[model samples]
Target: MAERTYDVMILGAGASGMMCAAQLNEKSDLSVVVIEGNEKAAKKLKVSGGGKCNITNVNVSASNYLGDEQLIESIFSQFSKEDLLLWLEHRGLKPVLRKEQYYFCPKSSEEIIEILKAASAKSDYKFGEEIISLSKEEHFVLKTKKRKYKAKNVVIATGGKSFGSLGASEIGLELAASLGHESISFLPALAGFTLQKNAFWMKELSGISFEAEVTVAGKTLYEDMLLTHKGLSGPVVLSASLYWSKGEISINFLPKNNLVDLLHNNRRLLSTALPLPKRFTQAFIVHLGIKDRACVDYKNDERALLVSAFHTYHLAPAGTYGFSKAEVCKGGVKTETLNSWTLESNILENLFFAGEVVDITGELGGYNFQWAFSSGVVAAQHIIENNKV
Candidate 1:
């Protein structure tokens, strides 16, 4: 029957929410509180990067991101990569770099969650609470099943609408609307695609991965392309998946070697460079009904055409795995409605937004998590500086 009030209440206790709480609580005057739907916070944290928790990335810049790229530049400037490295080091976390510029904790992801909780306990308020409805009076009022809480400042660290199994959703959009705000369209990002019609080759060559370039149109993919039982995956395909509205993606079966060179040099040895899985090699050379003709087997003009085709393999995906498997959602509350530097809502006074809940989405590697941490820090620091309860 008692009303609980705090200086700051953060929804969603995943990466962004936790960072906001720690930053606020570290300050002397603030009483930082986190409301999480899950019985335990950071369930998504444990599953990220296959439980290693890819925390951030190296060599990231505004160009590596999508969405309102211009506006996102200011946000990154506010909380730079150096800021993330400094903050994580302050928390006693040393991350290891993985392939593809990803940075992950050397320990298990559970350790990452524990580190957050430990810092949160220092001065932050963390309640195992789920908010069902939210409203505002002179101050922001949050309603849970059991009680009501008023906060001087409210932060929607609630992540984007994706990965429902891990409790990701668009609840923040509804909450923002309740307070007279508009949100952006939501889409799945960095997820695998399914085909409307089965590609028989997927069954034949399910797990083949090669270190090669994936070019869509004229742009070269910085990541590798992998063949899956369902479809193509890996950084390049996932990156292309973001821009693919509706069409086939182009892929090169061989990256460095020219089909002509393979043919001219030694038709039989072409397989050495691709080092393709036995099954995929069958599809490319044997099952295709080409034998000794190998690379050199074809005449000059004919070899040229085949080499070009190999570099540009077009594919149309059925659809993505949807939110359930997405690493991050593509869209959220549009950037125009919120302050890029502070992530505060222009429509709602004392209201802030950060993390995947906004339209900004990053390429795979640790960029998404880095965005979450940096954006949350900016929002919390801004609230601490600009607002009073």
Candidate 2:
């Protein structure tokens, strides 16, 4: 059979790939084909944000991400959270702002997925087809198990190696490496941390949650934290994991209250005397080997020790829950190899990278989705505008 030909071939059909295809379909006459290895498109998209799909954040800025700050700033300038919301509204997928930070589809992720599918309906979709080999000569050649295609341009949006159950892969980074690009080692971000021996008592409090502040790597985030059977999780812990490459994390369980004063003058047991959860306080007090005595019964040194412990509970995590539980990867192909404006490879004229496959990784609460959408749109528009050249 004769080899197929197209002007552009987009690998992966996740958030970025589908977004790019949709934009190209509307603005350019270039023949586009989206290849996805999964049985369906946007597998992760369908389940993101517990199916509601936090598409972006209302307070998106370059500060909310980790990567080349200049590149992220440039992309957000092209498509801000406001732009994403407006674009969704225009496409009939109304997004609701929640908690003054997250933008979510009121219905489900399917709402946005359907809009993207409809917008890119003109483009061909090859589901269950994975590109096995890619080479370049006069043009770009992509070979799958069953067929081969030649295209003038290609876009890599294969995403990161997180959530492998949803079909995440490293092919996008691998492709970039083939073209002489620098890639950063990927680490699981936005995941729970497993506690070491000293903090193993936390595991017994599984299912318990509290409002607190977690600090690591000189960065702090205040949110709800949950004690899991494995270790620590929830919003605060997940966010802390973004900045915590390793070492200890400090938790302020009583961030809102001054427990030291209350504890010093208390007549009740340490567990019930403080404002923290009774179970947690009891377990912590016992772990510290403090006698359950009246405040006056304890010496000044003991009071100070208890106060210091409450204010700064240090925990050394053994590791993380790994990629299976990770919401995103922290690194990818370095941004210096790609043009900040177009996300195009500096060495290859028509090759481009976008979304999580790049070194840019956003914090929790929909920042990652926004980055994917913005970068994909920017790359798509750039490719179309320069197609005639």
Candidate 3:
């Protein structure tokens, strides 16, 4: 192995790593290099947003994420949602906004990946190189399986361990710990939930979906709830999983209509009167231990029970589907240890953390990618601005 020197060495050529390398190369004459373990870069980004790549959300705020709220807010302040869009458009990556405010590449995820590759064309990328260890002595000394590299600054853009099959690992976390950074325990977030044995009835409602509101851990989201053979999923369930540490998740099966009023005047069967899938209604009423009697025959108490069942159906999940099915991990290196603006470690000189590897995990949508890109840009900007002096 030969000794190589560079201005900065970024770990993991994912979203943040690519962004930082591209911007840094563009702004200054700094020699930058990206180290990746996988055969190709941005494997996760290539599969994101169902292959279309949700670039960023039109609406982003401090409340759209979980972690050090102050740190997250300050990061966004340096790089806002509009700032990201302008940067993308300036780079000729025109994205389309759909499903309300989510920005996605109309062609495919490859469009965004291509743009990133082009942007970072000047930076050297070493794929299939796994980082074994790192140490700082005047300059950051990083060791990989294939070679040794030294740099003035280091950026750990390796994402959280979500899709292990895509080559995600805990190396970033381990490296951060080695450099004296705090971390919150990692858990599967934005993933499906396996049901408890008590609510095994939900399995029968597999393939059935309804637009409902789900609440867990004091946060509520209104989106499509999907019933699966293993458990619950879909937009709302996945969103709720981010907040669900451990507790019962409540759902409003009928959020759009007042089921009680419909039940008061109708003689229709309990399964037929309410606005829900017949299969779901049948399973729900049966699980409630109520026969499919005419809705009008129910007394006030019975009606109340029905209302409660519809409005506040609570079930404790056995556990999440794990990192294999998670879109992102819920935790990472603690925020207090890093400078909120530059993402540089407070205690470690010229060392920074960015992307999902940091403690801040955004909600489902493009918030995660935005955080990655923004934090990466922030770190690179600080380096570029300071290097000029």
Candidate 4:
């Protein structure tokens, strides 16, 4: 069969690809095609936020992500969180705010996916087509197992390798590398951390969860931290995993109250005096090599030690849960290689990238999805403008 051709060819039918296609379909007359490795569109999106899908966050800024701050700032300036919310509302999909921070679909992820598909109905979708290779001459040529395709412009939105079962791979980074664009290897981000042997006592406290302040890599987060059999997993831990590559993380078990004041002249047992669960406090006390006597019985030095243990419990994580358990992956095609305003490759014209395929990785929230949408719109708008000239 003859190679199929289009004015624009988009890889991956996830958030970025679909959003880009939606913009092109709405604003331009270009013939666009979306090629997806999955059998259907937005497979991973369907499972996001436990199916509701965190579309965006109440608070979004360059500080919430790990990448070139200037690049991120540029993209968001083009399409901010307010712009995204307005767009969704105009399309009859108003996301509801959860926990007063995250914006989630009122019903399910499919609600937003359906809107995107309806908006980009003009674009043809080719599902279950895994791109095998890509090369460029007069136009870009992309080959899959069954056929070949050509396009004047190409958009890479294949995302990162986190959901392997959902067909995630390093193809996006690999393709960029083949085209002479430098990329960083993807690492598991927004995932749980397995503890070192020194923190094995935490494993015994599995299933206990509490609101605490966690500090790592110069970033401090206060959220619920869960002690799991593997080590630690929760909103705060997942966010901390984004900045932490190695070294120690400090957890303040009593973030809201001063341990010294709480223990002041208290007659209760050391474990009982703490605001945390008795079992958890007892285990920690035992791990600290401290007795569980009354708070009044501790010497000044013992009191100081207790205060430090409660306020700055430090531990080094062995590693992350890997891509299988990661909500997203950090690192990809470096932001420096792309036009920040358009997400188009500075090294190669008419080639664009968006979503997790870019080096920017946001903390666990709606930040990642916001970046995907913002970057997609930026790329699409630029493509539309380019076609005019």
- Top candidate on lDDT is 4
Q: Comparing candidate 1 with candidate 3, which one achieves the higher TM-score? A: 3
lDDT of 3 at 54: 91
Encode model 2's per-residue lDDT on 1-389: one tens digit a residue: 76667888899999999999999998888899998989899999999999999998877888778888999999989988888888899998888878877889999999999999998998899988876777898889887778777888899999999998998988877777777888998899999999889898888899989998888988888988999999999988988898888788898888988876786567887777777788888888888888777766788788788877888999888999999999999989998889999999998899988899999998889999999999999999888987876
TM-score of each: 0.91, 0.96, 0.97, 0.98
lDDT of 3 at 211: 93
Clashing pairs in 1: 248-315, 263-295, 263-296, 293-297
Clashes of each: 4, 0, 0, 0
Q: Model 3 segments beyond 4 Å from truth? A: none
lDDT of 1: 0.75
Q: Rank by lDDT, descending?
A: 4, 3, 2, 1
**C-alpha lDDT values of all predictions:** 0.75, 0.88, 0.89, 0.93
Tens-place lDDT per residue, model 4, 116-215, is 9999999999998998888898999998888888999999999999989998999999899999999999999999999999899999999999999999
Give the lDDT of residue 124 in candidate 4.
Answer: 95
Error of 4 at 166 (Å): 0.5
lDDT of 3 by residue, 258-309 (tens): 8877887798898888788998999888888888889989888878888999
